[model samples]
Target: MLAQNVKKLIDDKAMDLNSQGDLADYVSKKITILNDYIEGKRELSEPNVDDILSEIVGFFTTSLDIPLEEGTKFLRARTYKVNHLEVNVPKLSYIPLDLSELATLGRLNKEKEPVYYGCIYFEEKGGVNVAFSESNAEVSDNVNILRSTAKCDVNVNYVGIYDYVHRQCKPRFMPQSMFEYFEAVSKYQEEKFSESVFLAHLLCDAFLSDILRRKKSGNLYRVTSILFSIYTESSDIDGIMYTSVKSEGDPVVALKTESVNSKLVHKSCDNYRIINDYGYAKYHAIHTHYGSISGNSVSWLKKNT
Candidate 1:
């Protein structure tokens, strides 16, 4: 009976989602200025850009259904220092960067906006390699730089940039029913929301554009940053999961600091080093450490070789 009931529930959800009511009509009505702007048919009026962005934010926040009840686990890496050869373990502060010290724009974060970033598995490589790749770590001959990465478990409810674009890798958290509904809505030519939804897709492409390269402050950062701020500000979305430009489409999640503080948990942190030779790179792990957080800092407790 339980198995039959589960099947019935799944079937009912499929049927209900298939019968989407007025979604295309509503989106078409909301994104008039943005649709015109993307089609190259007209120039945006003085305040039209702002209005269009508002519409985009509204559409994503309301139209997309994000399931964040289940927490997703990923690894976050940061440069680790051991007292220049003094300390023997890593601290809790090593888990994430201090937002108060933020000096530049990220692909999805404005300066001082606390977003905890993590990477998932990519091909044969695990989340650790993807995390280090996302770090843009450099290889130096004279200097030894160590990195510490932690496994972060949290409910990272996110918006994605993978569905409509060609990517080297697709994240596991990619939304299923919501995007298909948009695709169906985009095919409704009689309602003409097709063009509108398509324009919105172009905006999403910008979010993953090669121009907005990782770790560099591109000129378009302001625009993309605004889009991010607006999309995350009014919603319960804890993170924005997008493809990492430096990692060949590896998935990266940028979680809100508040969310990290409240929901993130990890059992251990691993220390490692990256060695670069000419054009090739190698990684070596040295130890794993455990610790706890206090007031605005962390203290390392123990370590294992």
Candidate 2:
């Protein structure tokens, strides 16, 4: 169910900004095109439609700015489960790490300004309830059941679970405000909404209501640098865990890095550049936002900060 909801949001963006009502219309068009391409009926890539898809992903990340405060807050509320997160999942909580070992990652790009979305370690879990995705070729990039691409078009990367949600779990159509108003109504009677219901409203606001609010109030934006904190731990769980407020604009996210130890922000487009203290290389990673991985970057950050 969660996967379906996410997919709807991603697919809807293929048609328009973030309206759930518009998702089917956009997806229908994408599927039709993909079918034509698969049957040798059309070209490989459509020109402009992909941009729309990227925009929709951005809207889901909670990074997109909606003008009205209610809309902004609503979008923030829905884009992710940042709630009860700190209480139940200690790992989900944002922690500041010492980049004194900054050379381990790379030379910080001291020039660029960074947008801050708190961090979480990216981890790879095993023996989980689900398995990973197959490949990007099996599904339409625009709908992105698996895989993603950036730069406004061309879906690339790991299979996205959100696309499943879009295809299977979209809400019945209604005006954005009206839909949420009903939520208020249910709560007004002191009704206890289920966890799923709460998440539904959060996601609904992120993809639908929030974008509408941005369109109306002039709060929409394009982003550049994205910041995330990578964490590491000792023992059996070996790898890295990276977390941040994930956004899905087709932008490449020219990376601007921040650290608790280093006061300055580093913005770098060169993913391969390495920084060494006393000519010794330690650790380095290519930067991306809302991305997933296994384990933490370098132990618990909470100890120092």
Candidate 3:
């Protein structure tokens, strides 16, 4: 389905040949130096990091323009919840983080930059909900959490990362746009597409090596956050979609706070209280609520469940 989506994007817009030659020149020259550095043929020197990042940003900008559905749902889990007794009270639990709350670097946002991070439903393998994994929430007899779900109320363009997992990872998705970019470059330069593809994969592995690591160290997020900043520089993109590291490559999204506040509607939320055995986890729904947006506030209705 993803490959077909890319094909449809290609069909809808004719490839602009104007930048093809320049893109080809840049990749061909950079790939050789990158390979030399990997092979220890030359001592590691600081290659132009911004130039490489720019090429990546340029590739996505030129290649695809897939828009997400208006009804797409995003699931966000919280270790805490709103403590209120009223049935129709305003709540901030289902909204994006406040500016003061967003003081650290996240998977895609820089320090102090507000972003709405959520796990999306994966249709492959019947269905998979990655919210728990993405939130790093583990429930047992002693642990429980609240989950807030929101629906996209407007069509938004989110830039997607093609399959980036190791080949050993299961269920590799189709049509990696990185290789496609290099292949297009190869076409203009009359270079072997396979060779360019090999270099492209090597580049991905080199640059994104720390992307899937489980550690939440601040330094690890520096590169990805920079990439996202570059991608959104045009203002045409509202967010980014990438594989969730904690969920074994399940799709996840990070939308700018402005985009989320303007385009997403709070749908519902559930409080799961675990009451099972110590080694096992079972969710007991303590409460459920349906949310309605008003002006800048969200009012909730107690749902009997």
Candidate 4:
């Protein structure tokens, strides 16, 4: 189905000479990569389908001067029921990338982009509901489907919550926390270890605060304890801490346990701690250098979470 969708995307678009040539080149390279993988001559990692599609879309929209809406007509439309409301929202389907598949590709000599796709459905009926994608890649048209419809008074109170989560639920950690984390990483990459360590400690503190807010734990000591427990108990602390707890039952427990057991979570926490304690001043160091988190760590977080 996905392959067909991709092919449809390719066929539907009218292309100029340059665009056609680029498309042919891209497809030919991709096919060669796949063939090599099949014959065991080389290992091919799955490319991110959405990203590749988005790049193709970009070629049409930017290079060919095609309207954005016209360029994204090939994406599969999916209908989702808004919780507590009788509205059915239509959206483009997103596929999930699997880490195990990426790990398999990582073992190969050459770099391969993992191309797994899956959609996350909202099972619960209420609260601030927000759908997000990992990539900010311009894969889909930004034209609003709801613009033509009359605005209904569904739940005004939930609007603020939705907005908050929308901005916070970034690719990795919340945007601000992710920024700080990356800044620490950048410092480390620059060989400014002390500054990197300080920023890392700060990042950990920010992360803890976010967790406490989500958990609704206001007491500082309790927050600290919960954060510590989360770091210690779960391998995927971010997943465990970030996953919405819609209902209290086996489902939540199962999800929490699975996230906690993830190796990525363990590594993230371990790195956080390592950076936190690496500096001479445990909590008060002020650093000028900025660092970005390593790509491997970022990939791990994205995959595991």
Q: Name the runs in model 4 displaced over 4 angstroms.
A: 1-173, 192-305
Give model 1's TM-score versus the native structure: 0.58
Q: Which regions of candidate 3 are displaced past 4 Å?
A: 1-52, 59-63, 81-98, 122-129, 140-194, 205-218, 274-305
State the lDDT of candidate 2 residue by residue for 128-190, as single tens digits.
001111111111111101111112121111112222233432232223553343333324212
State the lDDT of candidate 4 residue by residue for 1-305, as single tens digits. 12344333333433222233334445435334433443456643334322332343233221101011111111111222221111222111111233233322211011232221111222311110111111111222121111111021110000012123223433231346533443333333224223323233233333332332343222222222222222223232221122232221101101122221221111111011111222211221112111122322211121122
- Span of ten consecutive residues with least summed lDDT in model 1: 140-149
TM-scores for every predicted model: 0.58, 0.20, 0.58, 0.18
lDDT (10s digit) by residue, model 1, range 3-66? 3443454344334433445444555454554444445555655255556566555543222324
Best of the two (2, 3) by lDDT: 3
Model 2 bad stretches (over 4 Å) = 1-23, 34-41, 44-46, 49-305
1 versus 4: better TM-score goes to: 1
For model 2 the TM-score comes to 0.20
lDDT of each: 0.46, 0.23, 0.46, 0.23
Worst 10 residues of 3 by lDDT: 274-283
Against the hidden true structure, what lDDT does model 3 obtain? Answer: 0.46
Runs of candidate 1 with Cα error greater than 4 angstroms are 1-52, 59-65, 68-71, 80-103, 121-125, 140-217, 277-305
